[model samples]
Target: MDARQTWSSQLTYILAVAGATVGFGATWRFPYLVGQNGGGAYVLTFCIAMIVIGIPMILVENAIGRRLHINSVDAFGGMANGKKINKAWKIVGWMGLCGAFGIMAYYMVIGGWVLNYIYNIIFGNLNLTSVVSADLTASFYDKSIINAPFAISIATLVFVIINFVILVRGAVAGIEKAAKYLMPILFLLMIGMVIRNLTLDGALEGIKFYLTPDFSKISAKLFIDVLGQVFFALSLGFGVMITLSSFVRKDENLVKTSVITGVLNTLIAVVAGFMIFPSLFTFGVAPDSGPSLVFKSLPIVFSHMFAGEFLAVAFFSLLMIAALTTSLPIYEVLITVLEEKFKIKRLKAIFITLGGIFILGNIPSLMATNLLSDVTVFGKNIFDAYDAISATIFFVLTSLLCAIFVGWVLGDEAKKEILFGSNGAHKIINIWFFYIKYIIPFLILVVFVSSFYDNFIK
Candidate 1:
């Protein structure tokens, strides 16, 4: 058997976890959600949700993994000796694994799109002008992304190959090293953008829109939206925290680690709001552009900035780094499962996983454009269908099961994990347990039902 692997330090573990949490969403989707949802009020709700729900669950997932010191699937199965534990609970782990795979299948396509844009900017294939319009940017996306199907396929393959190389190198050498450098660079670039954005004329107007709370916007949907953001933004519900924590040294302070990771993730996302909204308002652009906020809308702003070419390079570089950091932990989750369950050699397992993703992912990439545009699953194209299944159904279901398992099934053992080394931790653990058992699961169920309605029923 292979010798056990553990993160060299708490810092590296935190970096890996934070990296997983900070993806493309941190750059674009988060700020957009804040704008559309409730701005400052949404931010306030999200922070509350993170503290009450997100942080506790992070600790719970880590405790399960560190205590068991195994892959997610076996963590539940190993909760008790052999057949004593309900074997069906292991399906929670399977759900997580499947969710990760499903997300990655389409996620790589998005990553490729980022890469293609980066290439266009650097190589002058995309002309960077002083003034750009939404129409112009839309045309560029259509020509480059929608019209060029083979390019996307090649990009996806390249992305899969890149992940395979890093993953095959093992965690410490691959994930840890990448996060150490990439994360800092990502922060620096974001800070630069934040400074540039704040200096823009009418920047404060955007800041006002972002910071001033409109409490009336708070409602059932607001809570649900904030809950979903808190859940997904922290990379919860995917066995990722479990898989990553399995590599953490037991004596490490998981409480501090969880808090720090959650705070940093939220901070970056908030700063991303500053990076986007201020410049958006200064350029006289609307903030409600949704997914196009990143690719279509941002490019117009980028063109208007001083030394726009250099800023564009930095922005895209930051994006690639963000995508890579997020991809690492995801790859680890899938690879660890393959390594444990199939007893396959690490290299062989990497190839097997990548080969499968490469083949399955192409279908989504094609459907995103011309070839399979007519294909629909429950009224969604192949790409959107995969996204809905993973994000809405599998992700929420896994989180609910995790809360149930830790709160009820593990019972006292779970409490011990939460309260392990702290003085006066019992009261806090009690509050956490109550929330996890009752409140958190119910909240997740609301999101699950809402998602189901939007995806299938509505």
Candidate 2:
């Protein structure tokens, strides 16, 4: 995307980044991870990690994207002067694209679940079953497979319309206005839920689980996941942020925006944990599990907590918006690339991505299990395999390239762009370079090297 065609105001771009960063990584996923990682202790550390490691990386991403006016792939390559990195750097872009779209493909399916629950809630119907454990929905629960695909289809159509209408309308008309409206409403609804959760019976226990620290679980893997969450949440390496930054006028502050977006994003995750964890105790379920804890466990747990259908209605509504905010950006990145590279109409690009994802999205929809499985080079689910590949494999490579680009090749322009945007940011920027150049890459290397790769070549 041309710098001329992106968001106009700094705030809009920050909101757009906020929109991208603040969703699944925070909402259900945040609580779920805390549950899995040994309760509030992990949650506390994750938040701390976000500030220490995530913030600088976000600045790096925003600066790199804004300064280069190119996606990370091309940006990384052009920033380098040595060997031809054109091909190698392009792989970063492709991996980012794959990761974003791949996530959305499955995500739309989950988003559909939220939509289905909304309909079921508003209509005063519940898909309750006696034999079905609340943790796992009964056999009847392929609601996404049934209703979600169509819902996603419609939503994707609407998303395309909204995105292009904004992109075409220019920054003020489209991006800023949308963010100004959408982000506040999202935060408001979530905050209200958090306030409500605070009064619940088991809320404090849940809070501690989410906010308190358990030191033993802080291992290399936990840190790695935290690092990945920072990257994944910020929409880095994918060129989405780059594309968003493209719209800013040169004077717009990049560093402050990165920090603002990071703070807001992390705050939401913490709030989400506060809102979600207490519900586990309120409903009498273990909160120590991750995604499965939410989907399989929480539904049943909520059934026990709230009166009648009110719980389902509230939880799922927040979820739908959360999912939409995140998923929208996935398509945004694709649309930006397609429109720029193919000169295709924005509408056409949106449809192509939607349609392609709709089909690929089904591999999970059809399977009785996570699509991450069934993808076996040796013997792991496609879901786990992909998670490992996307987060660990691609992330390590991308971080290596990004660090090398920012710290080694693009240092001066990066310095100028970051310093121009904020007060006392250069010190952080210097530390950022230090981490990217040595610390982060080293941590990522330990993750990769220590990882016992399953024999699955496929």
Candidate 3:
């Protein structure tokens, strides 16, 4: 492989990773899950999981990448101490790559929805300034976007092309440059939304609902949900962290950077809760509205607020930025695989990967509209099937293998990479190692089985 591309600076690395970690999972999925699973209880469990499980797994991926310093596929098969471990371990990296691709395929469909919303809002197609009723808002999402095949497909194509443009520029000038701008704007939009939402009447009630813990609501199921959320929200187990970290400077502190990435991810999810719940309550909408919370419910809330159109624009723009930042890295994982493993040129790899994604993405996009709405895989539509299989199976399985690889296989070598620039913080390093080695794998196993039960068997 050619000399690996490193981030231009530590700050850029942090921002890039932060962009990867903090995507729609934090901004879109977390709030709804908290509402459904018991607000404060879910948030608390998610935080604990982030500390014990999320951050440690992140450190493990970083260690693997920095130590191996190859693309995800080749990295696993690459040398460790001048010897190759079993090539079967390469499956773990492939799983991560496949999982990332699977996710990006459907993720672009949703990204298209965000793009559609932004365009419609800007063009007066959505008409938020008018006295739109809840039914009208819901209908707009259902009829105009979700069920509109051409609209959704075009938007998805545009979103994919946007990612392609940025990624084609390579890591330093492309991914890092986008992150340098997008991450800050994402935070600013999020904060602005939170400030605006909190000022609404009855906002305090939503805040209370979000923060006041109901201990009685905690359960094994809730914990399982929290586990899945933390993993997905942090973008772990997908080789994203590993691929991004492969470019890190040798002396950078893995522990500090991983923690910072994890913290920023969790912070965005929490802030999303604050931004969303207050608005939901203020508008007399149920917080537990499932995935539609952002698409259907929020629009209704925005229509009633002062400067509702501007807020709608900002909110969807924030969502788009989060989506784009994340899509870039996930898309890069595939591009890197082609470039490193097949010796394909970067430009050719970009076209090949994007073409595949667009083709595969069409399945879900068409399934959402009248064109292929009847199509089903494993008794679920293309979109839900992708989401279920990726989250419940591929994600957990890859994460489990990664934990085993770093914890047991790499062992002390991995520890050395993690501790390289930390000035010998042995105690913390040991603690992190313990969780990665033993606790995290075991916990992921529980989540794996439980996820199967919840998603498939049950």
Give the Cα error of residue 406 in candidate 1, in Å: 0.4
Report the lDDT tens digits of candidate 1 across residue range 1-458.
13677777778888888889998768756877886775788888887877877888898788778767788888887644223578898999999988888778787887888888888988887767567778888999888887777887777677777887788779556888888888888888899889988999989988987888899988766776677777678878778899988887656777778889888988888888898888888888778776656777788888888788778778877877888898778878888888887798888878877787767865465556578888888888888777778777888889889988887788777777656544456777788788888888887787789867766897
The local distance difference test score of model 1 is 0.80
Badly placed stretches (over 4 Å) of model 3 are: 81-83
In the range 309-346, model 2's lDDT, one tens digit per residue, is 56656667677667666666666667667776667876
Q: How accurate locally, in lDDT, is each candidate?
A: 0.80, 0.63, 0.85
Worst 10 residues of 2 by lDDT: 449-458
Report, for all candidates in order, the number of backbone clashes: 0, 19, 0
TM-score of each: 0.95, 0.84, 0.97
lDDT of 2: 0.63
Better of 1 and 2 by lDDT: 1
Which consecutive 10 residues in model 1 have the weakest lDDT in total? 76-85
lDDT of 3 at 231: 77
Alpha-carbon RMSD, candidate 2: 4.0
At residue 449, candidate 2 shows an lDDT of 57
| Alpha-carbon shift of residue 307 in model 2 (angstroms) | 5.3
